[model samples]
Target: MDIGTSVITPSESAEDTLPSMFWGLDPIYGVFAKLYIKDILELKKSQPVPGVFFYKTHPITKVDILGTIVQKRERERFFSFGVDDGTGVISCLWWKKQRAMENVRLASSPFGLNVLEQLNRINQLENSNSQLELGDVVQVRGRLRDYRDQREINSTSVSKVVDPVFTAQIARMLELPYLYRNFYDKTFQIQMDSSDPNQQGEPTLSLQRKIKQFLTQNGVKNFYQQELEAIDSLVCIAEQNCVSLCLHHPSQTSQDPPSSACVSKQIHELFQQAVCALQEEGIIFQKVAAHTELYLVTDAEKELHKVTRKIVQDDSTRPKYVDKGCPFHHIVSCVRHSYSAGVSEAAVQRVLDRLECDSEIVSTMDRHYTVS
Candidate 1:
């Protein structure tokens, strides 16, 4: 499949394709969700694609979801369970191949006894403690399939969630790309403002504008506290020097200007809040060094770092091949080969996801990819 052309449609607006009613159905696939059972059921189905549902206009399939197992049932051929991730509940089914394995074991008996040992090893691995249990938080990777006209997951892999809080953090991290993509849309902007009052704060907006202005004037991609402090001082000086002709004007008051300490404190607070807001919007990022945080603008520079790190890691593990006509170049391979310090598989996957979403890469087949 030409993923760049088929799976991703960055130029088209989702609203244009969405149904008139909020509950309209659509076919969506290959997306993940971290939502409650109620929210999952509320998702609209797609008319064009039968048996497919959408969440926030994004198609979901082969999802990586985190939830707590609420119930479990084991049958002769399969085990099924219900998972509730706070929003709603969904059933997950894992089919057993024990009977097939037994047949294989019996057939292998004619061969060396070593074959039976191998069969036992496979059985041990299959019956490991990875099995689902009621009340256990778990992460599941699976396809959103249907059985008996009801939505369920045909799970591919299911593992116990080591830390519920950490799993929630991972869910939020995974959702960032989608949120960032829609952030600038007018409808999304309104939705965000309605949902979070802080998003529309006048002070925060003013601070962000000022930061942009300062960065532009300095021609720098980032600014540390020292630079921010210098700018703050200049602004205070300009404010103090302003002439007030009207007696009724607040600036005409004989009261003394704010002290340097007060000015510094206020500016510090403003800058901190502005940086946080920008980071949440995926516009900037921060690094902590020696108990101080340094802010940097994110864009091409960040992209270069991510790509370069991946290439370097791949070079160490695999032979370097020309960018074009490299059969081994694959998204999963790149992620698996990545060896950056402090980087996780989730982070590498996010980079690949973003690149694919932006049409910078195309999928040739499952796990296989090429740059566009």
Candidate 2:
């Protein structure tokens, strides 16, 4: 039965009168008198209560949330962004797998032109089913939330847009062959020395030493573009300047394809590894002001290596897919090879959940063939 809608039969009441919220004649006392009993408790408190439905497990007061940006960190694969209604704020997490959504743009510019752009986008969002973004002023409907680390939380409804703007800086790399080809081509050109077949068609001993020396001296280590972006994000965040880093994954590359879930997991795992590595080296990460950016200090390279090691460890645990490659391989290519592949957010969440539960291997267990 629904908490609020559950009918209390006459036999259940002592006097055959409906329970009233008024005092004196019919007084409501404690959590038992509320229409929704389960909606009023906390998780820590809910653990001790037996037979309580998940819905009634925690009941929080609804508060107004206004003027807040919904943000998800690059390293934290959690898809939801938190927003505030005038009364309270809640975190809204997305679960869809295939759709690619960007946050609504909020204009930071003072010029009327930029403001007009935001206004136009806001109007479009009013009719669209798209999610809110960086510069949206929306009214959220949910209960006030509290967590161990957080004092206030909310589970919000997606409704009522007030002001909308896009206030994010995304790095978009355009592959203009006329402009970037020279720089791009040099990275992949043949540095290997080899002499053309002699006119006589005889093996030339004279070219062997030069070729060997060239091969030994020059080498290339390919890196995924996303990995490079991840590293750049860390550095940018470490500087304590940017809110988030966004990169455009090139479509022309023939490298590995990335699943949505795996990419998110790799970023988060890498972040955790980076934090751990920093702690080992005496570097520390401490929270600054509320809802503000995070800071990383001391040796950046060491922290990066910590993130790298975590990525490597995570890569080893991912299962191989039949159509696309294994999630781990995709991640490895991103982190180690600097390649970018398109991945859905849902796929990323699946990978993160697997990592959290340590059940990725179970997916492969079902695929094993029985010997005859």
Candidate 3:
């Protein structure tokens, strides 16, 4: 792979190896990390599988990347392409079956089609049957490997991007920075299974217990998944009020604080399991959708559920909404105006979902509710 320039190192010890750390890096197995090639090169491979790698706490076996094809070499069953994503160059192996091309050899365009559509189909077929060209901007998703002492990707799928406006490329650039800062860049500490039998009301000590205790002790009525303060709180509870991420950069002295941290894989697993168990037991629930990560405890908002139901029932009979029922926004507006101004669309959405689940309300159409 040709980089066209010398590789840039972030620090003096960036390339130097740290102590082999393999524990608690297994939960993220099969998660395809969207990352730059430079970060891929620096991934710590402590897991047994050759393809598995870790960046701090994220375990990655597969990755998807966007880059320009700088070089290409054809082989018998597969072809290799050198990809440059501005950070570095990495070789990607893309495999293909020759029989796919041999099976569908379209002689001419089919009947029920116009000139433009037929031409586009034929052009797509020809493109699929051809070799990749240099300077082509492409998307590659694959497992990573080391061959001849070089990091490379064994690509599972490949497609040439047809973006005239740089939309996809720009979108990728914008999205990856958030993921990098929120996930890939955060480090975490290795926690011990400390069993403290001295506590008066506590049960058997474990990671799940610790995290749950943290939420309860701190009175964290709600928290999002990516909240660093919550992550730090759990870490503090586990490690007894200490900044616990153990990433050992070369420049750090004995007194340096742990920086930009997250939980380890085991802690991450326990944390999620605890949250799910809490939700299952009705101790906590997300105020909105799961993607929002906005969790709320059982009595956090004192539950405007009954108020919302009455509002929906009363509004559904109004002259304007009698036939079509009440729109969802109207219910939200009523709940906020009457019950609480801080109520979110998602909270009202959850109330609607619960009402529907209990057969208390019927959905006439999209977001329109009526008394069941």
lDDT by residue for model 2 over 37-96, one digit each (tens)? Answer: 112332222223222212221221343334356564322332456554233444554333
Q: Which candidate comes out best when scored by TM-score? A: 3
Model 3 Cα lDDT, one tens digit per residue, 1-372: 111212223332211322235333434455678899898988777444456676765557789999999999988778899999999899999876544433444655477546565656766774584468898999988898888888899988788898997767866886687678656665533222333222211211344466556667777777765562357656555443222323232344568655444324434544555566556555566544464567775434445778888998998999988876887778989987887665666567767888889899998765779999
Q: Which candidate, 1 or 2, has the higher TM-score?
A: 1
Q: Candidate 2, residue 104: CA error in Å?
A: 30
**Winner by lDDT:** 3
Give the clash count for model 3.
0
Per-residue lDDT over 130-174 for candidate 1, one digit per residue giving the tens place of the 0 to 100 score: 476788887777777667867788888887766845645444444
lDDT of 3 at 83: 92
Model 3 gets an lDDT of 0.66
When summed lDDT is taken over every stretch of 10 residues in candidate 3, the lowest stretch is 1-10
